[model samples]
Target: MTLKIDCQLRDLDFTEVGTHAQKMEEMGFDAAWTFEAGQDAFTPLTLAAAATKNIHLGTNIAVAFGRSPFAMAQQAWDIQKLSRGRMHLGLGTQVRAHIERRFSMPFDHPARRISDYVRCMKAIFDNFQNGTKPDYKGEFYQFTLNNPLFSPGAIDHPDIPVYLAGVNPRMCRAAGEVADGFHAHPIHNMSYLKEVVLPAIDEGAKTRGKSVKDLHVQTMVLIAAGETQAEIDKAVEDVRMQISFYGSTPNYRGVLEHMGYGDLGKELSQMMRSGQMAEMPKKIPDAIVEQVAVIGKLSEVGPKVRERYEGVLDRVAYYYPIPKDAEIGNWKAFTDAVKHTA
Candidate 1:
């Protein structure tokens, strides 16, 4: 199977998205993804459409609870129209605290609710694309009205692919049942993907009478790589810090445990709760880092990534590019190696 290489933009700024997208496409990347943390995901992608062609654009995840289905559909549809069909709608049910406290939105039964949300949005999209009256009723959401004057009917791309990001089985299954893809969390290891996630997807697809092959599985993995040992060590430190920060969040304890670092996770969470943010990174041992990340000479990354995810993954995106200042040749070499092997 040919594994598609995908990459996400740095959260720092999006002013150079067009320039970056052109460069990424030239470097052989199949797609560009953006995340919504403190910024809007759709806007940067909309800007990217003005800059390049061919590379698919998507939100790695925009909060599902933050917007109504109608609003989400409207935004995704507009981007799809502008991109001439190169758009993917990725949704996430972020934790209840962020949804309720940060966004001031209601949150409950995320799996069921998001499943309902997807159905509602698809129903809305169908109504808009087919000029049919809207009448969808779900446990969590209902849409019974669509006025012709305000609705912009079908475009060239009416079926924008939908992907959902989640760490639990309920979400994996839900993605299989209703979404076109599953965006695996960066912290996930091969064991989790093969033992937990794949089974969930299979079960969900079987329940829905859908083929597992119909769902694209994409994962972003931690990387600590460079041309030289010094560069590799520096990148390793950065990834260690990031991994520790993630482990400190109790929500990810299961992932750490899957990597046989359960105690490390507990300690990190305790430190975080006690406001020892500076000490958290120091707690991540080298072994834990090695288990959760792919660290080696830059030349080894592509083959190792391919070895780790060859059968289970459809596409892979790195947590971040290594040797921040490395020449584009480094990235080109890495991607080319994977392509030739695949």
Candidate 2:
């Protein structure tokens, strides 16, 4: 299968949005994404939609538990309209601590909660599309209020594709049950994906009389690459820290276990609880890094990524680091390489 390479803007620049989007589109990259980590996900895409044509845009993940279903539908509809139906809204139910402590939201039965949430959001979208009153009721959320005075009814594309971010089986299954696509967590390796994630999603789809082919599987590949071997080595070390951090999360330990590295995860979790951040990466050996991330010289990453994901992904996004103050954006080579022609 032919793969479509996508990238994300690390920094928000309204003035340079078109300049960047136009350049990426010309570079043959298929799409662009924004994250809800530290900034608003749609703002960058608002500028992107105004500036370019043809390139798709999405949120890598916006917190689903943080907002009401109607709010999500309204915002997603606006993005889809503004982007001319190029928006794919990606939602995620972050872990309980973040939900309860950070967002002050409840976290329980996440898979079932998200399933009901998506159902409610779609009902809202359907109401907007069909110009009817919102009359959807789910166990988690309900949208029964509708007034034409405030309703921005009927857009060019009411059915914006909804993708869900998932790392574990229940979330993966939930995505297969209701979402248009699945966003594989960056902490994942091929073995964890094959052995744990996809099979659960397949079963979820099967229960609904659907199949794996009905959902787009988009992976965020963690890679370590640079112009020189030294830079590559540093990047690898940096990514060991990243993987270690991911491993520290109890939910993600399953990935480490599936990869035969359960002991590594246990050590990292202890270090994390002790707040020994600097010493965490020391516990992750190079072999573990190799299993979790792609490592190569600048020219080699594209084909290598394609090799690893050949039968698995329909779309892939590269997540790596390049110094902002450097003379050139090192991620350029990664984008070009994944395009498979550079």
Candidate 3:
């Protein structure tokens, strides 16, 4: 199994990002992905690209509705060039409320939108690489930039891989049909991944006359590693809180409900909607915590990560810093444990 060690950019500043990127590359990490929930994932990704020589730089997910596909294509192209062709463009359609209310953008037919977006991006990149004009006219986006002055000439391999973040079956299927890879949400368990997600992807691929081998399955796993049981308990609680925050959303509640935690899901939904943030974590049951994250000693964490990839996922992106720490000793331990497992 191929393991891809990665973390979010949340716990790292600019200087720390550079250092982490180099260190992660040295530690045999295949990729380094950053988050863009409230911050731009591109700036740090550029810094990571500059700092590392081989490790792939990417976003866990950059919101799609916030920017036009043209802009995304240009950014990905530029980053791929800057990184010497070591860039992965991961995109996701954030929740409807965030898109409609916060960004004032339409969020209709997300699966279809993502499919078109990927096709349009590929066409644009092909145009730049082949010195030809791309004529793309879809329901959502239409563009034809021929002989443009701002074109970045051509790239060696403009076919930079596109990864899609998906949780629902439709979105997962769309990822299989269009994207080069599929990124499962961190809250998902191994059972859901194997039973629900993988089958949907395979069905989608079959419809397109494709196969599972054509796509990569990448999952983000929250890992908290420590030597002592007290430290492990604290880390596990931190993961539980994070899972509570993610599970409180109505969309994610479905997954929790599927896991036979419908009552907890309803409670979390009520709390989140009422803005009772402080009381949210208290509702997350211990059983749900074990299902979501790998929280334990370094020895235990490695096996749990391996379990996720047993017969389903192709890569695991281990997110670090369950809490704040100046030194990445916990991350180092987790990676060392993963290597030992291999």
Candidate 3 accuracy as TM-score: 0.92
Q: Which stretches of candidate 2 lie over 4 Å from their true place?
A: 13-15, 321-342
Q: What is the TM-score of each candidate against the true structure?
A: 0.94, 0.93, 0.92
Q: Which pairs in model 3 have colliding backbones?
A: none
Instruction: Name the better of 2 and 3 by TM-score.
Output: 2
Which residue runs does candidate 3 get wrong by more than 4 Å?
322-333, 339-342
Candidate 2 residue-wise lDDT, 1-342, digit = tens: 677788775574567776777666665667888888777777888888877889898888889999988888888888788888899899999889999999998999899999999999988888888866678888889999888876778988777889999888988999889998999998888888887778878888898899878898897878787878899999899898898888898888888888778787788888989999999988888788888788888678888888888778789886742233433334455566665656
TM-score, candidate number 1: 0.94
> Which is superior by TM-score, 1 or 3?
1
- Find the number of clashing residue pairs for candidate 3: 0
Question: Which portions of model 1 show Cα errors greater than 4 Å?
Answer: 321-326
lDDT tens readout by residue for model 1, 1-342: 788878785553567667777777666777888888778889888988778889888889888899999999999999999999999899999999999999899999898999999999999999889987788999999989979886878898798999999887888998888888899888877788888887888778886788668899998888888779999999898988898888887778888888787798889988989999888888887877777789898788889887787778898887783223446776787877766542
lDDT leader: 1
Winner by TM-score = 1
